[model samples]
Target: ASPADMAHIAAANPAAVQGLLADLEAMAQELLAYRADSSLDTAGATIRAQAARIAELERDAARYRAMRDGLVSGDLENNPIGEAMYELGERVCRERGHDAIPTAAEFDAAIDTAMKQPTCTCPSGDGSLSWPCPQHPPEVT
Candidate 1:
C-alpha cells in the first residue's frame, strides 16, 4: 500500500479516537473481570485443595477395588481367606488411617500371617454361633 493510503487509514477524528480508546478500555476491564472469574478474585486455594483431596479418594478407591478382586477369586476351598482380607482392610482403615490404600502384597502378607486351619466353623461374623450356619455348611459339623 502507498504511504498516503496508510495515513488515511490511520487518520480519524480526535473525538472518535477518544471514544474508541474508551470503548477498548472498557472492554479490557470487562475481560480482566472475566479473567478473575466475575466481579472479584476467587478462592482458588480452597477449590484446588478439595479437588486434590478428591483425587486422593479416587486413588484410594482404585486400590480398594484391587483388594476386593482378590477375595472374589480365591482358593475355591472356601472364602474364609477373602473374608479375612476384607476384615483386614477394614481394620487397617480404622487403625492405620482412612486414607490407607493397601497393596496386594500387603494384604497377602496379612492373610498369610493370620490364616488358621479351618475350624470346621464358618468365617461369617458370628462364626462361633453359626458353626453349622446355612451360609457355609461345614463338611462335618
Candidate 2:
C-alpha cells in the first residue's frame, strides 16, 4: 500500500477489521503454498525468488493481522475500499462462479490479447481509442 492510501484509510476511518483479517488469512495461505513448493523439489533462481516473495508476504500478513487486531480492539469507522477488497478476496477463495481461477486457455487468451496492439472496435468508430482499427489516441493509460 502507498502512503497516500494509508493516509486515506486514516482519514476515512474504515471499519475494516474483518476485511483486514480476511486479507491476512488469504496472504498466509498463499505464503504457505509458496513455502511448501520452495521446500520441495523446486530449485534454482525460481525457488529463491519464491522464497523471498513468501518472506515478504509473511511480513505483510503480520502487519495486516496487527492492524486487524487493533481495529477490532479500537474504535473506527467503515472503510468501503477495504471491505470491497476483502469481499473480492473472499469471493475468489470461495470459488464463486463469478471469478474462477484462470485456466491455461484463459491465460493464453489474456496474453494473446495483451500482446496484440489494442484495437478500438467501439460503435463510435472514432480514431481516438486504440490502434489497428479506427480509434486512436487512447483515452487513458
Candidate 3:
C-alpha cells in the first residue's frame, strides 16, 4: 500500500496497522529462511554440472565435424596420403572405364601387387629410366 493508504489505515485503526506490520515481518523471515536453506546451492551445483557436460559435448561434436570434413575433403593438410591415393584411384577408374571401378579390397590388393613388382631396367645404356624404371614414366624433376 502507498504511504497515504497506510496512514489512513493507521489513523482509522492503529491495531490493524500493527497486525499488517507483523504479517509483513513474518513473510520477510520466511523469505530469509528459504534463502538460507541448501536447496538453492544444490540446484546451482546441478546446473553447473549440466552446463559443463553440454560444453564438453559441443567440443566433441566440433572435433568430429573437423575429422569428417578432413576425410571427405581429402585435403593435403589433413590427409595428404588419402588425397593422393584417391587421385590415383580416380585416374585408374577413368582409364579402365567406370564399369570397372575397383572395390576397396580390390584396389588394396591391386596396390599391393603393383608394389611387389620388380623394377624394370631399360636395356639402353643411357640410364634414362626413372627410379621405378621403364614401367613408369620418367620423373620430371
Query: Which candidate leads in TM-score?
Result: 3
Q: Write the per-residue lDDT of candidate 3 for residues 1-141, one digit (tens) a residue.
A: 999998887767968878888999999999888887768888999999999999977755654554465578856565533544566678778889766665665545443443333444656423552355554456721
Residue 136's lDDT in candidate 2: 34
User: Candidate 1 lDDT, tens digit per residue, 14-118?
Assistant: 777888999999999999889888433456767788899999777556556655565677754455556667778898798889989777777766655444343
Candidate 2 has a TM-score of 0.24
Give stretches of model 2 more than 4 Å off.
1-42, 75-141
* TM-score result, candidate 1: 0.29
Residue-level lDDT of model 2, residues 22-131, one tens digit each, is 79999999999999878674667777998999997775565456446545765444543244345555655577575666454543333333333445666666545347
TM-score pick, better of 1 and 3 = 3
Q: Residue pairs in steric clash, candidate 1?
A: none
Deviation in Å, model 2, residue 104 alpha carbon: 33
Residue 10's lDDT in candidate 1: 67
Rank order (by lDDT, best first): 1, 3, 2
lDDT, model 2, position 128: 50
Please provide TM-scores, in order, for all candidate models, with all chains considered together: 0.29, 0.24, 0.32
